[model samples]
Target: MHNIVLFGPPGAGKGTQSQKLIAQYNLVHLSTGDLLRAQITEGTALGLKAKKLMDEGLLVPDEVVIGMIGSALSANQQAAGFIFDGFPRTTAQAESLDRLLAEHHTKVACMIALEVGEEELVKRLLERGKTSGRPDDQDETKIRRRVTVYNTETAQVAGYYAAQHKFHALNGIGNIDDIFAQICLLIDQHKPAVDEAPAAATREVKA
Candidate 1:
């Protein structure tokens, strides 16, 4: 399996690149933010809990987030692999994810970290807020707080993956296609090769 974690702060183009990577690799795209929104829209019990926290401008608990991811994994049993976006934001979450994947006899192939400057991130997010209709993005203070929180809290997740030799940092400022090509090169290096159908068939016949 060629599981990947697409890591970055807000406005780092993780979402855009995730779409392209999914199409190119036939991988299941798992965005935790999207998953949580789905639960909220569906009015699940977990969603109710998450909603209360979100309304208070607090993060949903790690266990709740992990539960959602577990459910997603169960649903996509036959996927080629998964491209995980907006997840494993903490070292604990990273550890949990590793354990969960190990249960399926697969491990993360790599974590592609998008490195973007704080000022550029702020500019992109503020511009996006104009059209995104997201209150959090609209406020300069909130945007900087989110970035600061990422740096102080979530950035350590990179070290967790790095210790396993599964972290790759790429510059996030460039032509989209050029950046994607660089990411693909890294993925291709780590993704396991699929067995050739003809070769497998021949072996079965000989057997």
Candidate 2:
């Protein structure tokens, strides 16, 4: 499996890029935010617990999120691979994800990071806020805080992947298709080569 970790700050268009990658790779999409929000919208006990923390821009507990991911991996065993979005946002979570993938007999092939400046992120998120109706995006203070938190808490996760030689960073300021093309190039480079077919036995020939 050619699993990938779609890494980037908020408003870096990770979600948008993930859709493109999924189409290209036939990979399953796994977003921790989406998973938690699904439970929240369903009013499950876990949802109630995550809602408050999520609204305040805090990450949900590693164990809780990991449990959900485990379930997802099991359900999607037939997937070619998975693109992890909004997950492994912390070093602890990254370690847990490694263990989980090992159990599934697959590993992250690469972490493709979309690099965008803080101001650009703020600008993009504010524009998104106008239509998204997410309170966290509506507040500039919260947005900046989220960025800061990402830098402080999530950026370290890059080191974990980098140590394993599986991190790739790209400029996120460009045409959407161009960015996707660049990302695909990187993915292509990292993709594992398939085994070649065995050669047929040669028959004796007249000399």
Candidate 3:
């Protein structure tokens, strides 16, 4: 599979670009937040477990999240590929994801990150808040905190992928179509030539 781990801080246009990429590539959207909500809506055991932890003001364990991802992979055996969003927040989670995908005889095609200046992100988010009705977006302090959290915590995950020659970064301040075109270029360059072939595991990917 030509799986992708799409990364960006808030207001970086990830949502807009992801929609285009998904439709263009016919990739499954494996957003962890959405998956967690699915589990809760379905009343599954894992979902119940996650919801309980969330209600208790505790973070749900990685295993539960991985379990949800594993189930998703199993259920979508026929998917062209998967686009992972809001997952693998740590290097440890990245390692775990590698192991899980290896079990399925497929691997992540690339990790694409959208790079934007913190000030621009803050401006964009605050503007969005005016229309989005999300109080968190309206608060500059909270917005900065979120950006700092991404830099200190989630950003480290990029290194794990980079060490494997699977990381790509792009400037996010550009025309929407221009940015997406660049992202597509990178994915096409790195994506396995044979998506479903058994030999995909050993395919050479361009850095």
- Best model number under TM-score: 3
lDDT of 3 by residue, 100-138 (tens): 999988889999999899999999999999999999999
Report the poorest 10 consecutive residues by lDDT, candidate 2: 198-207
lDDT value, residue 50 of candidate 1: 91
User: What ranking emerges by TM-score with the best candidate at the front?
Assistant: 3, 1, 2
Clashing pairs in 3: none
Which tens-of-lDDT digit does each residue in 30-128 have in candidate 2? 888777777678786677777888889997788878877887777666667778877788788899999999998888889988989999999999999
The list of candidate 3 runs beyond 4 A from truth reads: 197-207
Task: Please give the ranking of all candidate structures by lDDT, highest first, separated by commas.
Answer: 3, 1, 2
User: lDDT tens string, model 1, 37-58?
Assistant: 8888888888888999999999
Cα error of candidate 1 at position 42, Å: 3.4
